[model samples]
Target: MRPEKIAEANEIDARVAGALYMILADYNGMDMPTTNELKKSLRENGASFNVVKNRMLNRALSEDASALLKGQTAMIYGDGDVVEVAKVIKKFTAAKKKPVIKGGFVEGKSISAEDVVELSKLPSKDVLRAMLLGTLQAPCSQLVGVMNQKVASLVYVLSAVIDKKEQEA
Candidate 1:
């Protein structure tokens, strides 16, 4: 390859690294076609995927490369929100009898394949938010009931006292 093309490829590698950083943190390398299909599946779900040379990617990340995804060199790439990428990977991979989520990294932290699957199992943000709201409302509902009961008891007690006083008068 020409020097300029090599440089361009390196630039592409860096981009792939950044994209992969947000996607697969580490991987258990798959066949070329499988990787391609993973990319296609992700793309259909609104995430883009890429396969990049290891050396170029390592150079691109400098010192922050995650060990899970680093060394020997090679990577699968995906892009979009990290959670979305994770969701896509988990969904397609789960559809198969055997899934390939090797393990991966995000920012600088290494993550495991099991971790990825676990993350996929998490309820969506909206669902979590709703659950929190329900929890918050539960306490408020209990408080409302307590206040109503206290007020009712106070009214009943005062009414009894007045009736007793009227009888004595």
Candidate 2:
């Protein structure tokens, strides 16, 4: 490859390094159409996958990107819906008898295949977000109930006072 071509490849690889790191960091490897299929599915689902050259990918993963490239930085590729990426990889692996997870960088740490399995077990971002919303709303709902009860008690007291005054008159 010419020096310029090599540089360009390296640039692309570097640009995708974060993505690759995310993939390998979250998954192992896939079989033929399964891999391609998964990649396609991810793209359709608002994510992406890439089969990048190791040399270029490695070049992109310099020490600066190490935090996100911690463990197996050499082979990694994917971007979008960080959690969804992992979930799709997980789903494909589960469906295919032999699609194994490799490794990946998560939040600047390198993780193993087993670690990726654990990642797969996690609920998606939306699920977590919903859980958070429910958690927040629970207390607010309880507060509203408590406030309404207090207002009802005041109303009852006033009603009783009016009833007694009318009887006395």
Candidate 3:
């Protein structure tokens, strides 16, 4: 390989290694402004987008990941939330109808394009964590309420007994 090609491949490799997840797509018909818009959105979501040659991608990515590489491939990758990145891509696709999803690897496992869409549909990490916390807290809260109710009932019974004794006296 030429020196420039080697450098490019190294760069791709570095990006892949650094990212927690990557999504591949066919960005064939996307114009410059549209691509720029997508890039901007992805950047805001903590991902970077790049158009890479299939051969270079193949050289950089693993065997399973390389299988998705064919024809006008662009890679979107980030160290941030994978779901957020997928949401950005899905939103862009819904609006522009270009850069169709191919497939990608997340945390070293290859996933289908449909999986990427499903991921986009999911709540973000913080949301999921909050849901889990709520679920866990519900039972504890209920238990506390039940205990408090028993104590209140006891207090009411004692008060009623005191009133009856005073009336009898």
Choose the strongest candidate by TM-score.
3
Q: Write candidate 3's Cα lDDT for 1-169 as tens digits.
A: 8999889989999999998998899999999999999999999989999999998888787765556887899999999999999988888899999889999989998889999999999999999999999999999999999999999999999999999999999
Residue pairs whose backbone atoms clash in candidate 1? 25-104, 25-105, 26-103, 26-104, 26-105, 54-73, 54-74
**Candidate 2 displacement at residue 121 in angstroms:** 1.9
Per-residue C-alpha lDDT of model 2 across residues 1-169, encoded as one tens digit per residue: 8999787786675655545345443234444666677667777756656555444555654434433433322243455455666667677666774345556566556676777777667888789999999998999999999999999999999999999999999
Clashing residue pairs in candidate 3 (N, C-alpha, C atoms within 3 angstroms): none
| Ordered list by lDDT, greatest first | 3, 1, 2
Ten contiguous residues with the weakest lDDT in model 1:
20-29
lDDT of 1 by residue, 65-156 (tens): 54544533334454544565677777766664323555666665667777777767777667788999999899999999999999999999
Model 1: lDDT of residue 51: 48
lDDT of 3 at 88: 88
* Candidate 2's TM-score: 0.71
C-alpha lDDT (0 to 100) for residue 93 of candidate 3: 94
Query: For model 1, what is the C-alpha lDDT against the true structure?
Result: 0.63
TM-scores vs. true structure, each candidate: 0.58, 0.71, 0.94
Off by over 4 Å in 2: 4-8, 17-21, 25-32, 63-79, 166-169
* Best model number under lDDT: 3
Between prediction 1 and prediction 3, the one with superior TM-score is 3
